[model samples]
Target: MLTVKPILPRFGAEISGVDISKPLSEEDRRAIIDAMNKWGVCVFRNTGLDDESHIRFSRNFGRLELAPLRRDGKGRLAHRELFDASNLDMEGEINRDPSAVMYRKGDRLWHTDSSFMEKRTSYSLLLAHQTPKEAGETWFADTRSAYEDLPQEMKDKIENLKGENSLWWSRKLAGADISDETIENGPKAVHPIVHTHAGSGRKALFIAAHTKDIVGMEPEEGRRLIRELIKHCVQPQYVFKVKYEPGDLVIWDNLCTMHRGGEFDAENEARDMRRTTVREGTEPNSKDDDDPFTELFTGMPKSLSRLTAPEAEA
Candidate 1:
């Protein structure tokens, strides 16, 4: 039998007694799936998972989304950025110019992975390889509760609203030159501001960093409304911070949670963790599809792009 313990009253659970480093029995695996459906976040502690082990374990949940070279560099390594944060500089400043994108400085905005893509991320698995003396926890907001807390009037307003989301907006914020092909293939795609859980039949707010504007609204008005909606979805009462410790693995439902990286001395300490994302099929809301970019493999891996230069030099 599985020993499942709640980490928080509203969300999060720690699952014990399963050695993720090895193959799991069918019963144990089923228990995990059930726990994931019950609690949006499930944590497995100190399972001795290296890169290979982490990949293997994540595969148990669903199909693994390949880390594109554009996103993870030319080699496109097995795991994405999960490691000991202590490997950073004494001042915690992220050095290594070649690794700049992975170390950009920002207020760590809240978002669900690949919501901009037609195929959204179903879940995310992150393992803490290093811990700090203090600070640097990741925070999550229960989007389900965010929607529930909305004023009835506001809920009615969003019930029929759709917003355009795209990767270009986030890439632009990150200071990268987005290609025309990227723009054409990745223009804003529309999704309902509120979505029903395909599994549990519960409703959740479905907007985040990748969201650009509400369909058919003037830019300024849309901006104001989206800002308000996002704020509503990230209320303090629905949020919690996860302080990292070495050997800690956390997985969350990307559909109903919004997460932001916490403050830490990146200049003085190292914080590393590996992450894997599993995708749920995309289901867009009805709209004109104003985003010119809509190709699935356009700016993806050069190997998949028909009209790209040689993959970036390693």
Candidate 2:
């Protein structure tokens, strides 16, 4: 029997007694996926899987995409689908880079994973390889609820409107490079500001990454309206923070939730974690998307050697 229980009423679950390191029985795998779809995030405490083991487990859900190249570090799992955010140096201080426009800013912004990708990540699995004594928490917002709360007029206005989301703009904010190759290969695509979950038929807000503007609206007008939507979507009431413990593995559905990393002291503490990204497919509402691999990585450097984005430009 499955041993899954709700960790919170809104968005999280905890599953126990199943060894994820080994091949899962078909029924067990289905149960876990069901739990994820229902809860949006699943946590496994005292998880025994190592980096490779964790990657294998993520594959059971869908095709696993390698963690983005720019997010890896040495002596860490930054190989193909794994990212190591461990012991990074920012201004001669440890962990200080958490707010670095490039390295750890995603957690500060409430966003669905890889929404900037042609095929946005469907789920994110993060395993805490090491946790500092006090900080390093992750927060999540229930977009499902965030959407339900919008005024009908706002909803109707965005119902047919599609957003032109771009990593190029985000990378630029961080001062990351934008090459001619990147521009040619990486062009902005449109997705509805609201998405209907394919599996559950639930709706969610899809806006993220300081999106440049809406597809058909003037930049100034789009900026104002998008800002209003973001403000409404990320209100404190719809969010929750999860503190990490060593050996805790977290899996989140990027389709229905936006997540951010919390503030922690990098000056004196250490934090290391591994993440695996899995994508089901691009949502039907997204427009003009193709070659997810290229769309997901075009503006970023070809290799992990240059992981910082434009935001971090000194």
Candidate 3:
């Protein structure tokens, strides 16, 4: 039997006694899903999953979304369904590309994955293949708890408001160098600032770094509000930090929480992780056809990007 233990008072749980490398029975899946709905984040210790096994396990939740191709058009790391979240390049060496470095820096800012896409993201499954020696933890904020703590008046004020999200806008905030074409073709999506969890029917504050501005408000005012809300959501009591280890898999509900990668010595340490996201629903948004990163990969070479083994030297 799988054991679920609370890791934090309000938001995270540690799940043990299940090997994710093999197929999960229906009962196990239900228990896992129930735990996710209750805790918002679940950590599976010692999963020991390879790229293929990772994809297989993630599919148990829902249909997997293909990762966007690298800007270089070389190909994606491991399987097409895996989003490469490593500091290393295709050759398993520290990446020195200025653009890639800047892009990775944006992960330090709290945000939900694929929020700029119309289809959005349901859950994110991140498997740690390698970890730095220190200070490379990931932090998660319980937006569901943040929402519950809000004043009734504040809740009422944002009840019907929507925020526009753009990938280029977040990159700009991180001071990343991006091309005109990338911005022009980037996704712009509008989603409710307050999201209702599909399975649990609970509400959560959904604003994050990708949130550019509120739909009908003045730009500066919307930005100010977003900044304030993010500040409130990340208060110490509402946050949980995950210090990763190789063979660890952390699954988080993108709809109810916000997360950011912790700072580490990218120049000296190797931090490699792979992620697979499940879409919230079956149908793709019409605007998904215009996703800038998707367009960049069209006609790109098909090559399997390599992953650094956990035992590999930094």
Candidate 4:
């Protein structure tokens, strides 16, 4: 039987006693799902998963989305499902140049993965292949708890609001040099600022860094509300942090939580994290016939285009 220990007063759990390398039995799978329903995040330590097994394991839960494509038309991992969340370059070395790593600074802002995708993103199963020596922890906020704690008046006001999210907007906010082509044609998604979480049957604030503005509202006023809501969502009571170990796997529901990456000495330390994102559904949303995310990967890696010469980048 799996042992689940709650790590925080409101949410987050640590699960143990499972060999994830092999297929999980239906009983074990349901228990994990139950834990996920109760706790927005679950930490599994010493999972002993490599890239292949990691991909295989996440498949048991839901359909995997293709990780963001690289501009150079190369992939380090065999599976497109494995998204490289590392501080390292494609060559697996630490990136020291500030400009070359500027785009990554966006990760520091609280956001849900692939929220800007047309399809609703559900769970993010992130595995640590390598860990930084210090200070590379990730923080998560219980948006569900945060939502329930909101003032009744505030809740009533925002009950039907929607946010227009954009991938380029966030990249631009992080001081990345987004190409004109991308700004004009990038992927955009509109989602409710507040929605009921299916598993837990609780309302959760789905707002995050990708939420650029509110739909059908004046820009500045809408953004102010988003900022205010985010402030409330990340209050100390709803927050917790996790420092990863090499074999740790942290599964989080993007629907009910917000997460941000912590600062590490990227110049000197290696934090090779990989993730398989399971969207709420396998099919694209009604509006997306051609994959809407195609525009994001068009140019060279935003950092490389600005910092390195063509030959040096290669």
Task: Give me the overall lDDT of model 2.
Answer: 0.67
Give the root-mean-square deviation of each candidate in angstroms.
Answer: 7.2, 5.7, 5.4, 4.3
Model 1: per-residue Cα lDDT at residue 266: 60
lDDT of each residue in 143-251, candidate 2, tens digit only: 8878888889888888988887765565554454446355435666577888897756788888866476888899899978877877776788777777888778988
- In angstroms, how far off is 232's CA in candidate 1? 1.6
| Best-performing candidate as measured by TM-score | 4
How much lDDT does candidate 1 score? 0.65
**Residue 173 in model 1: lDDT:** 47
TM-score sort, best first:
4, 3, 2, 1
Off by over 4 Å in 1: 70-103, 171-186, 281-314
| Cα TM-score per model | 0.78, 0.80, 0.88, 0.90
Q: How many pairs of residues in model 3 come into backbone collision?
A: 0
lDDT over C-alpha atoms for residue 136 of model 1: 75
For candidate 4, lDDT tens digit of each residue in 1-314? 99999988779999998888788888888888889999999999998898888887888778776754555567666667777777777577886667657767778888888887778878899998889788889999999999999999999999999998976677677787777466546567899999999998999999988898899889899989989999999999999999889999999999999999999897898888888877785532222234333354554445545433111100
Top candidate (lDDT)? 4
Local distance difference test values of all predictions, in order: 0.65, 0.67, 0.79, 0.79
Measured with C-alpha atoms, the lDDT of residue 213 in candidate 4 is 89
Residue ranges of candidate 2 with Cα displaced over 4 Å: 68-75, 87-102, 171-186, 282-298, 301-314
